[model samples]
Target: MVQYPFCALLMLSLLIFLATIPNAFFTQACLTTGYLRADAYQTRCPGVEAIVFAGVEQAVADDPRMAASLLRLHFHDCFVNGCDASVLLDDTLTFEGEKTAAPNLNSLRGFEVIDAIKSELEFACPETVSCADILAIAARDSVVLSGGPTWQVLMGRRDSLFANKGLANKNIPAPNSDVATLVSKFQNVGLSQKDMVALSGGHTIGKARCSTFSTRLKGSSSSDSPGLDKDFLASLQQLCSEFDNNNMTLAELDFVTPATFDNQYYTNLLSGEGLLASDQALVAEDGIATRNLVETYAEDPQAFFEDFKTSMVKMGSLKPLTGKSGQIRHNCRIMN
Candidate 1:
């Protein structure tokens, strides 16, 4: 009986020893398959996150809009090809790039900022860092700088050599998409409806062009159509009226706090002041679950921040290239 107890204690001791192994060992093993981890660059490029954050902070200081722009860049990059930084590619004579995609052309900004960050990293760490990882880090910093929650971003993502303008156009959700369409698109990428609602909160800091939501002002012929507030619709019509040269005219997604990342977006939706059809669709009568989510977020900013961080991390993890699967480009805009 004493021998059996001693054997049981010995087995327990062995289990404890195994549990004490550093997580980096397991992370390194998973890296071969492109698995992302918080400390993927801790040894390879010691201060990569700080370097990227400094660049982002400087850019945002120069142009507050850059915070939103950087956030949107990561979204566009991930939605199309799984955050591979393919969206950063410039069109070459041989191949068209995603920059001119229907969803991104003239809409996506902040490429120069990303290029600057990549140049700095190339100087500091040479080819040790990846543009894909830079984008993920910049996005998290942008949110934090804009008064949002901060989360540890998974690194070790690799950049793609090719760009897909077609997939970008198809994958990036339209500003006019309804809740159901938005939910379906998110579901296609392994995200749930709740994730869709939470991620859409990103609009809290961005701007949209008149062309993105002018259809709402055009007025529907059907009486049962969900209508925007008359005053809000009138303002949008006036803002979008100069259609000839006003295509580039900008409107804040969340007018209440255009430069801050917060829950005012959901509150705007409740007041019928949502800038995009998709934004309004979240709180529409037809979307019970989504509307409930909007209500929850509107009533609780902390909940929105927590969920947004989780969803952003989830979004960033999609189909990344790692461990010799893709190259780390010298220039973010060109293949090296």
Candidate 2:
């Protein structure tokens, strides 16, 4: 009896000791095959996250819109070619890139901001940082600056040698996508429907071009779009009519608080004020689960933030070129 109790006490003490170890160490050990580690640069390039965060901070301070642009950049890059920074490449003769894709061309911005961040990192740590990782970190910093939840963005992603313009056009979720299409697009990228709704909360801080949502305006189509608020549609019609270029005219996705990253986006959808057809579909369409998620997020800001952070991490980790599979680009716009 004495020996049995002594052995049990020893085992309990050993278990407590093991539990004290940093969870990341065991996590990295198991996930090292094709995944990244949060502290990947801690040894190789210390202060990397700080450098990227400071760069993003100054940029966002100068232009608050840059935060949304950077966040969207990471999403687009991850969706197309597995967060490989292929979206950052510039087109050249005999070389086509995602920059001109239907989902990107004239729509995506903030490349200059990324270029500036890359330059600082190269100066401080040389080629130790990959452009793909920069996009990931910059995205996290953007969310934090926009008053959203922040998660540890896993690093160690490498830039792809080739761009996927075709995938970029086909893979990205469209503004007019219904709840079903949105669910399908996200699922294609290894994310669940819960992630789709949470990630859509990103629209809280971005603006949509008139061309992206103009068709939903009242009388602009044969039937007034279902679930679209009448007053919101009239206002959008007036705002869009003022511009000679549909692409030039922009509308805030979250009508109440456009620049902040918060649950107001879900609230907007609940009130039939979502600027995009896809956004409203979350609440109005036949997606009962998505509608429940929208209601939950609208009722709880913390839940929305938590889900958004989780989804962002999962999205950033999708199909990344880890280990020796890809090369780190000296210039984000071109291969080293």
Candidate 3:
């Protein structure tokens, strides 16, 4: 009877040990593929997104020439999936909206930085890291360089092999899109109108090209222009005039949250101080959807983070390659 008890105890111990292996393995795998590491801070909060922003920010700080490519990586990663690193490619396949070059200078600058960062990292880490991961790293670098907060990011996303230029144009919300049109665009991507309003908060930091916001500055369409606040309209008109002669002063979309990733963007909308008509459109019409989302995001940054995360996941999934069609890119600029 004592022998039997000993055997039973050994068997139970073995079972417990076996069960813990997977968890241990999971933690180990996550150590490399997960967690954000930058400066003195190391965490996994914002996951891949934070790494990408920080990486690019750092790259730019090291070499201003890398800013454009890093910015491109940032935009692509954010649009496809909340910075999941799907835009990176291995030998397998590519994701949708993966074009050879950015359609415009703004995009071109961003993509160039991405290319430079990829090259620099490949020299340091070799094949151990993927382009997608580089994107996360670069994003962090970019933000920090621009004097923005460094967010936490998770990792472990696979790379894509293909690029879809057509889809890129179709999906990315244009600066001129009206509120309803913006709502539909977000809806098609599994986001709600409220989500659209919330994501627009990103405009807080980025500068809009003269062409993107020129319509607002021109007061082109009276129907839309009338909706803008009178004093704001005059300011926009003057700014547009200046931009017409000088492309450099293309005007900021959100003067308040221009750099910080906070709720001040929504507060601007509530006060009739929004920079873009599309932004103001959120509050100009309709029921509580706009106000509710703005208030929610304004009051609870965590809620905004949650919704933003969900929306980013949906955005990333816009048109991914599964079951093999594209290849993981060795070079994000050119196909492998």
Candidate 4:
């Protein structure tokens, strides 16, 4: 090895110390084993995930509208890098001309929830942890706290080097994908149709902007057209005379239990209350497998949690620049 200046060597040692320290006892960057497998990380994620979820839950419980904002965090991340929280930065792409379907227009209320949780954590633990991890865990917890499902979580994920707005526009699946297309999209990210439907459970707890549902309102195409409960559709029409194609007027995926994580999302589908045309398609004639997933998850929260955990693991694995693939950033929003 080439000899270096004492100062340079000291700096290298310090960097290693910081990275490892984050994964040690000071923060939630747990170390059950090593980085070679995801199971090692799983042992550490749930507890932290619960904390984040609790903060989000409290932030939005009394006000259902806040759910939309909280839900946007997950949408922003997933669209960019399989729920990786890589689209919340100032440099990230915004929805551009011709209506780029990126993860912009996040719910402002949701940011408040994360900020509150960060404040509490800082008060309790000081600077031992990172806010980026809090964002990921909070998004996960928000779903569970909203009565979605108890996701099987893993820990030890380093924050992203950069948050890409442009990337979000390219990766997020639309609200109107057909079964085959959705399956392919999820597969590209190492998720299954089951994961797609379960992750889509986020829809149960949030509101859609009017822009997201404009096509549904006009019945643009069979897949784009929503098959909502008759009464709910009428109520939606009353809420907006014509779709503004904005976030304010979108219908939720599960209206029956929007604030709670339960089987009701599936039950809603069975009842013709599925909020989007894509959601409805999960149970359409040729979509029995997916429909059964809804039914199965509805019947067993434990099973759902298992699938959710597996799916989350798979989702995180997609296109990851791990093991020297990507550099850890001091700030999650910027590329170092």
Candidate 5:
């Protein structure tokens, strides 16, 4: 009789102990098994999507170029550290951030807009949301507000505690890359050649510094190689010569439609009017598959929109830290 009572007491104690465990522990465990989803924040942070879009829309209204800047911010963040928002970190005494990397130093913008969105979110939900998710959402909203294709962005990505300046410099494809090099870079990041061509169409709404494309305007080294249009090259030279400083002069990447996200980027490429060497390389002789993709997108805006939507989702899915792996950062620029 005594042994039976002791066994019953032990079992009851174990049940009580298990019941005391926090629900978050189990929720975190479940999140480890799958990729993030569009509704990840539906319960934890209601109305988050609206808050992000409103902030992005207001910023774009103030400066139309902000749409492109935010989109580039997402791309740069993902390529370096897998959509972790490490690019948003500011340089501190103990930590060096991605802002000073070779490719991003003066090129990347829109941090203030991100900060504004985060402030609004913090007021509404406190520590319930992550900065990485905010960036992903802001990028999508930027595209939609700029007349680009809209897609559902996955959430629940946690902010990274560390930033990689070296990887940012190394992984970002250079403006002067050849077709093969561009293809290789995309492949290394698990993006297909078609994805590369489609994503490059983002150039439809952005501007590039003169220093990024001035070499191509100097004339081709080989006569057999195709070059930009003579008149287009002259126009570029004139626009880029306004300031003695090479980096200060800016030219629209898609001259036909600089503010709209459309197939005009591919159309411009077809006409030998691509602003950057990497842009032209997609249609170069060696870029058989990429050239085909460029022509297809130019001829069919619907196809480009569909494929770009898929590619953006695919890019955002790269190596996210979910579950109990990383923290939901209160401040995007600092580690908690």
Candidate 6:
């Protein structure tokens, strides 16, 4: 037996401790601090999800389109800076807010809806609930209210003190994105290509501005977009021409059952009715992986629902402020 010195034993113990740590802490770091759990507010703010659902139900009752808008808020917020509610901040003289970002300006509705929900939450639980968690819960409720899948949303996220307007513009996948671009955008936020395809299903219930897919219409190029259906192309052209390319003029992302959250979006992509260039690219221009996913989801609604819920829960886990790292803002629009 060999005898080891006290310093050698100490060094060996230190190395063993370091080896026990997760490789992700060194290789792929969580951009934000903290851990979130499904039962984060079980005691502090019990039935918080139900309260948020009530608010979302009322909002969706007022306008069915709001379901899509609220869902988009969670996507936009998570893509920029983890799951922090930085996207909720309004611009101030001292600092810029994500609301004015290129990807968000004039679009990204449902702010007033969030404010209304926040008001109710403040009355019920005071500052115990974070605005970030509200966005997540509201997103899930919005989907369920629209006849989509329901998932367990992990809570305990805290509101961001500042917004990243530049990241908002650069990070959110643009409507004109191709399959490769979409994959890259999602990957930048630590999401997989499968997650990207599934999350894009959220478009099943939303509307897009005419400007988003105007180029896919006739005459923008000598030839129509690849895999663009001829009849769908003609209708879109008429719609755009009628609006004179007005950005305010809108078209449903999934025209068939537009307000319903269903697998019809994938079915549309399979038949080439996908509205945005980024949307159709999944099945049209893309090969193998994404196209296969598009096919799988189109044929199996249950598969789509399961994958979508998994993706939503995964996306919600992005960099969150946990363990008292951030404050629970009294007003979602401003830091507390």
Candidate 5 worst ten-residue window by lDDT = 218-227
- Checking candidate 2 for backbone clashes, the offending pairs are none
Task: Name the lDDT value of residue 292 in candidate 2.
Answer: 99
lDDT of 5: 0.87
Error of 1 at 310 (Å): 0.6
lDDT of 6 by residue, 181-300 (tens): 988999999999999999999999989888888777755432557877878888887777786546668899999999999999999988878899898889865456999998999999
Model 5 residue runs over 4 Å out of place are: 1-34, 220-226
Q: Determine the C-alpha RMSD for candidate 4 after optimal superposition of all C-alphas.
A: 8.8
Q: Per-residue lDDT of 214-247 in model 2, one digit per residue for the tens? A: 6686475324788877777888888988878845
Candidate 4 versus the native: TM-score? 0.69
| Residues 5-105, model 1: lDDT tens digits | 88899999999998998866766666666578898877667889999999999999999999999999999999887989999999988778999999998
Worst 10 residues of 1 by lDDT: 220-229
TM-score of each: 0.90, 0.89, 0.68, 0.69, 0.89, 0.88
The per-prediction CA RMSD against the true structure, in angstroms, equals: 3.6, 4.8, 6.1, 8.8, 5.3, 6.5
Give the better candidate number (2 or 5) by lDDT: 2
Error of 1 at 151 (Å): 0.1
Q: TM-score of the candidate numbered 3?
A: 0.68
RMSD (CA, Å), candidate 2 to true, equals 4.8
Error of 4 at 214 (Å): 2.4
Worst 10 residues of 4 by lDDT: 27-36
> Whose TM-score is higher: candidate 4's or candidate 6's?
6
The regions of model 1 sitting more than 4 angstroms off are 1-30, 220-225, 242-244
Tell me the TM-score of model 2: 0.89
Instruction: Estimate every model's Cα lDDT from 0 to 1.
Output: 0.88, 0.89, 0.55, 0.57, 0.87, 0.87
**Superior by lDDT: candidate 1 or candidate 5:** 1
